[model samples]
Target: MAGTDAAPADSATTGPVDRAAWVALAGCLLGLFMQMLDTTIVNIALPDLTTDLRASTSEQLLVLSVYTLAFACTLLTAATLGGRLGRRRVFVTAILAFTVSSLLCGVSQGPVELIVFRGAQGVSAALMSAQTLALIAALFPKARHGLVFGIYGAVAGLAAMLGPVVGGVLVTSDVLGWGWRTIFFVNFPLGVIACGLAWRRLPQLREQPPPRLDLRGMALSTAGLFFLLYPLAVGREQGWPPRLWVMMGASAVLLVLFVVLERRLLARGGAPLLRMDLFGSRRFTVGLSLSLLFFSVFAAFFFTVSISAQFGLGYSPLRTGLLALPFAVGGVLGSVLSPGVVDRIGSARTLCAGALVLGAGLAWVGLTLQPISGTMSIPAVIAPLVVGGIGTGLFVAPLQTAILSDTSEANIGSASGCVPTVQQIGASIGLAVVSLFFFGQVATQAHSAVPATRAELVADLQNTAVEPLFRAPMADRFADCARNQLTSAHPDRPAPGCDGDPSAQSGMAADLIGKANGQLQEAGRAVAARSFVGAFQTTLWALAAMCAAIAVLTLALGSRPGPNKPE
Candidate 1:
């Protein structure tokens, strides 16, 4: 989910190659591109959907969390299914599912319906994700594996960078007045083309019979993940009620049951989806934890920044996307240049450098936002973003490599499946947790901000020469009314106040009321902006500290996985 975290180190045993192989690679990577593209594209549409659908902040969080939760829950199952059914057969089927789900998403009328469809799309994406590596393993001989993987990584990086821009264009243009719907509809053509190419070009390997799926394990895992994620996603928004706490406890118990069952099953000579032994190695544990921590922070970064740009500052979707472009560019360049850096100084150094750079960039952005109380210009956002992105490219690619480098080849399938799950879980948790902090800050700041804002407006008004002539008492009364109006459910629409009072129907009184309302709106906007600035700065600094922790962790990473290879 966080680019390249779950990439399979499938060192394929291959003998031959042809044009078919290249085409197959193209088709597989296209699927990869589409999958990654949706991840970023969805973020761009969040603010739009929030405004248009009258969605609560909680519901908006659900829109993002459901997809990731579903994807994480299904990765291991989907990976095994692809192996059992044959990767190409499963891959094409997933494309069909993804296409249909995209349709369902585009036409969705409400947040719940849209969230459900997004989960379906996530399930489909999980299926397709497994095949990206599987197809490459099946089609390309060992000789061309690196080349294909390079292409694959490039496509993923490009998609991540391009998603915002594309979403912005579609949303801004409101193609056919589709508004945010165009973002999903755009997936239709890509899914169709990818499906066609996959069906025709990908090889049909005679897959050996796969082991039986652990249905019980799947059930427990699904329920467990759901229980854990649901509470986190909604709890803060709901003020962390007792029911959620009970659910969290159930989630823990269910997951503990899963681990117990998996261990027992492994001892009994039955297959378990995840091998517990994989975590026995210190290096594997440390590296994967570090990777998970890094990814969570990475994912939370975009969500927070997107809200800051679109909701806080009132930037158009297109402009927000453009603001994110430099980050993506740096990400691509970092991915491109990282391999050389790794080859020279080793992965540990590369990871440390990346984490440090990312932390610094985030800190820089936080500093810039602090002065403005979270309000920012395009240049102010982009300059640091470029640095942060390069850090992302540097950190992400190498982190995946280092984490996988710690595990054995036999574990690659499980590791690949687990990697994304961890990344997604980290991302999902980070987003939910950070949103709690962010909104809490916003609410607290806004509470005090409202009165202060009104006072400032009144102070300014008192000093004006014409303030007394404009029915000063009426001005003060309307100002109080306007403050209440500013806090209405629908802030954009004009609301009834003194103007609606029959007793205040005098033309002079109406004019005074209109002036007060206009003044109040301006004051409200300024307060909202500053509150966002404070909240965003707080969240950003917290994330930077997280990054710095990861940087410190790199120093403790044991030598690569080979020294403690699995038995």
Candidate 2:
């Protein structure tokens, strides 16, 4: 918790919640905002990145996963560092690191470069974010803690939901034609100013006599998560080779070892990496699981929808954003309404209702996409997305209340710390699992599109007023070429002059081929669209399964709500 052991300005001169404290709080929120913004910003940009960077499906997934993976890995270590070196000092340094990395990310020339820099940004984000809560705990008086935390909650909620809308606006506007780079570049000024404000306004926090960091514990934990996630992110691309299996096994073993090591440390009278006892609470464990499960689906849903909209349907970035606007709007309403829902029913029932609603909405979206031959309409997309959003809010809005409602005060700091960790890790895991299905379907549907396209090509050729001999060969040739281009979201441009058929009319061969090409391309797009739609359907089912699990787990949480907890 970023060295909570420290005294904040001795609490003598400034008293609690001073002007400087408020400024510090604002700086921390800005820092939090940036991190949250980056998380959502990339979802909309994925399609653009996929095309512009020539990045493979796996690589594109990696770009999204790497940041979260790095963020999760570094969290314990960053928080520990904040404890030892002073939270404010470490937080400021991280801000500088985050800013510089954002600059590098903006100028990146290739996908590989972008991935590496994003990891750097994630690390900085971890260090910077770890301290914000600690600062809040230090600055806010007990009387006002709930209020400040409420504001924090509000910011976190908005940040989580607003990313796609902002990303759509940014990418659509192109902001000086900078394209996706503008998203990262937009961070530079905000980050710099936040850093300055933080350094000037934030107080230094030093643990009395300082604390020793468990480097061994940190390494074991990091290795375990890395091994676990690496294969998930890359395994599909490499066809899940033997080495990947080895990595997965090693990851499990390492995680087991981490658990053993933490237990031994706690038994001995030394600080452990993460407190093992936190898992002892049945409510905490179940709540953590539910949080992870929900967000995992949450993260993948946006990416899946974004790709479906842009690649599958041929919508501009702006149109894609507009369709999704309803989802975001609905989420806001859901967040506002979730408390009453929980109050009217119970946390468990509220959660269950939300999950089921989300599932139904997602099913609607999938069925809606099934009939789509090309380009999904905004009206069709809006209703289901908005319904799904409300369900998402219903599930999301009550998560913390159900989980932390039973948490002890001593564990509150740690509980607060674990929330995002669990959510992000779940997201990382969900995206990896979904990618396996999503990309696999893309390949499957692309291949499946060939025959449908070939038939359409033959019909188009027959109606073209072209000769039968030329038409037959031309359709066959176009089918072969079109099939080859199915892996791409777009169709390959057709070259003039068909092979064979010497008696064909001048330009007639080209014209017939062109007509076939348009359908063929549409067929490819339809396949890509259909594949994405298919994946989303399965993802929704998976999400429903998770919701069911949540309902079951809710049985474990104590029904009583805390005084500070939301209904």
Candidate 3:
């Protein structure tokens, strides 16, 4: 029952490349651009989203995390569905579906509604993403694969780097007074254009017997991922309860079962959602491992930096988003130059060089950060960010080719689909771990700031007309209040009993009270800034270390496969 109408013989792989092929490729790339853009675009809008929706910390996390969780969970199943139902059919449908979901997300009245629509959007993205590489392969000859994938990689990298910039612009511009909603709404035109192009120009290849749907594999995979990812996403916010630990343990068991099921199904000559035999190649295994490690670090780096820049540095959304512009420029440059480098030193060395440069850039950014007041000098970090971006461009552009070098033509679709799956899973795990680490450090740093806060408060009270007896106690209260404010889950809200009123002398002069409050507020800002800067610096160091490890891992990948010979 899973099939599409047969197409003309020329529509097969041997078909000549023409304007239609290029147009179809553009359609596919547009989908890729939107999908990748959405991953990080929403991040810059989170502050506005939180204010507008009155969303809690957990709800905010869910709005961001669910899209990725849904996308990662559905990729394998969607890829198989594409093979069964017809790639062009499923792809065009998904583009329209994604557009509708984005519209729904833009119009949602509550966090819950937005979350639901985001999940829908992610599934549609998966449906479209799952078909992209396979469709590209079918469209172009093997000899042009590198060139085609380079263009693909550049679009993907550009979209990701530009996400914050685009979001910031839209949210700041507040087009039609939509504020953050414009981020989602902007997808409408792009999706419609892509759908139109794809429907008309995307070739319908000849239908083969459909592969059986791996229903059990899909269920097991989905359940296992949920159990694993859900706990990580919410564990810190919920205080790391025993239930989360139990869920993680259950996740391990479920995933083991999923693997077993996959292998057994493959042995029985059944279609497994993930082909177990892909792991048989050391090259493929190493490539996947590298993806997991690389993406884990990359995702966490962006999340931490964006939060610190906006929250800690008191930057406007536009300023925070513009901070990535240098990186984006660098990424594009690196991507553009990657193929030439690969030709000279091969893919492994190019990747190694890229990783080393990225690590150095991260370290530079960490060192450049200062705990002082006022805006951070963007110029100080521009060079480092650009270096890091270039490194990212260098690594990402060739990663697909390297990963699939050893894979057979028959398994290319399966292997390509798994790449994004691992990347998303890595991103999910990274965000969870970084959140836990960053927030813990924030709390610890806040606690450590108490002594300084108390001293500052005592000095300010010395200039006031208050009695000595009341001064020490008031200073202690102020210090404790500052600590509580910094450590709260919602730091923007006032802490309890922090009204800044002198407890002992309710009848104190109004001028004296105002002065004391002003001093204390200034001190609080200083303490908060220092704590965040310290935490952000440490997080950067950790990520830089991971990048170095990625560089080392690149050496383990097999030599880049030779160029394809003409059949």
Candidate 4:
């Protein structure tokens, strides 16, 4: 909207103090907070949800992933509808629908019911999210764009980072005895308030002589995105089955066909769900690619850190959540400072600086972790987390500004939809790739620990009454059991042949046997912690490399236009 003509009916000349405009922006940010919060909040509550509903592994995956799938698939269509009907109208409707769906999720008694409700919530979230940028552009004048977008970025980033924190607090506190259901139930009041504010303050800014809906384009794009995102979401957990690859291939074909169809429609002077000319601008194209690369690091870094902190370090959910606080604080600081930086240097240089700072922070984090010590000092990592957070704040909002800098009024909605869709897909793909690397490293490290475990096992059995011949065999079995347990998919469950203590089988004295078993458990935990630490360190290095790559990519971005100058 910064580069586009203002709607004739709208008061484009309004300043930041215009109460209606600021209020409307507040409502949009609230909706955005809800949408981003959902992307990760339910994750921390999964263990409770699984037990409550008796969900299987596949069902658990679906419960977590279906929301993203639905949101990604519907974004393009929702954006188009918002432009044709009305941004405010569609946004308010989405808020009401999202509120209802969240309530339904809270009351769901079965896994299937919850999954279905989550999908509905996702669709509503897409409708709300797709209209946010367009609405912001329409409500605020171009002069205030940087400040407004910085605030928007700060809210969006903070919400995402705080999801686990909030989820952990709710699950631990068990307010109203709601347990995991509190996560969904909490959304009810927020949605109601957002809806009321938006409905009252948001003005209708429909496209004049509204374009006809391109039903075929919508269908193709939806199917294409669904096929592409679904496998990326679940394929790793499912072992990258051949069927998933086939789905990805089909997605490519469908998307290519969709593009072809849209081009032809535009040539014939028909309405297209997406405008092809948006990509013709080098800034939009490069900026979109940068968004994808940056987001890939964004979600993957959190996922790896969450697993490492909770499982590897034996941290409670609340502790894990608290660990991210430094990062959030840093992000807020960065967000607050970014607009001023942009004004001084420009968006491209600011993005480069952010990427470099983030990469350096990540590298510091990786170097600080010592797998040999088998322990992580939380205090040591806090500084790097804060630094990384600041970098995130600096990059995210400005990246959005850079991408849409050249988008025309007619294509703003489409551009908005494309940015988020690419980001979500990038996140999904990053998670899949990082999971493979992380788990594979875990397995390798687990197996490598066997010899040391065998040595410790033999030492423990040395003074026992167990026969010498049986001692070697018992040590071998114990080592194998430890490896198997550490590498198992469900590490919480005992691996086969690992349930009974080896000391009990050796017929030692009761006290000695208990002592030996305790030692064995300690050794097993050490192996796991070390394995996870090593894997986490490797992941951090990879993410840092990605950050460096993002910085390099920023070199290709066009410079931001000066005040009152043409882009």
Best by lDDT: 4
Q: Which wins on lDDT, candidate 1 or candidate 2?
A: 1
Task: Estimate the Cα RMSD of every predicted model relative to the unseen true structure.
Answer: 5.5, 5.0, 3.6, 3.3
Tens digit per residue, CA lDDT, model 3, 30-85 = 99999999999999999899889888888898898888888888888888887777
lDDT of 2 at 148: 57
Which digits, one per residue and each the tens of the lDDT, describe model 2 over residues 105-187? Answer: 88888999999999999999988877776666667555444345545654665676677777778888888888988889988
What are the lDDT scores of the predictions, listed in order? 0.71, 0.70, 0.81, 0.82
Q: Which stretches of candidate 2 lie over 4 Å from their true place?
A: 1-25, 46-62, 109-113, 137-154, 196-205, 339-350, 372-375, 401-417, 440-451, 470-515, 564-567
Candidate 3, clashing residue pairs?
none
lDDT per residue for candidate 1 within 1-567, as digits (tens), equals 011222223334445566656766777878888887888898878877877778776788789777877887788777667655666677889999998999999998888899899999999998888656545654654544434544565566568678888888898898999999999998899988887677767654323446678788888887888788778767755777899999889999999999998888878876677767778766567777886798678767877777766666777889888877888888888778776666666667778888888888888888877423436766676778888888887777666556554454345556656766776777778877787677666665566565566567676565444356554454456445544443443232234752344346667655554555556456555666766677778888899899889988987765542212311
The lDDT, on a scale of 0 to 1, for candidate 1 is: 0.71
Worst 10 residues of 4 by lDDT: 1-10
Ranking 1 against 4 by lDDT, winner: 4
Rank ordering of all candidates by lDDT, starting from the highest: 4, 3, 1, 2
* Among all candidates shown, the one with the greatest TM-score: 4
Instruction: Sum up the clashes in candidate 1.
Output: 2
Instruction: Tell me how many clashing residue pairs each candidate has.
Output: 2, 0, 0, 0
RMSD of 2: 5.0
Deviating ranges (above 4 Å) for candidate 3: 1-16, 205-207, 372-375, 460-471, 485-496, 499-513, 564-567
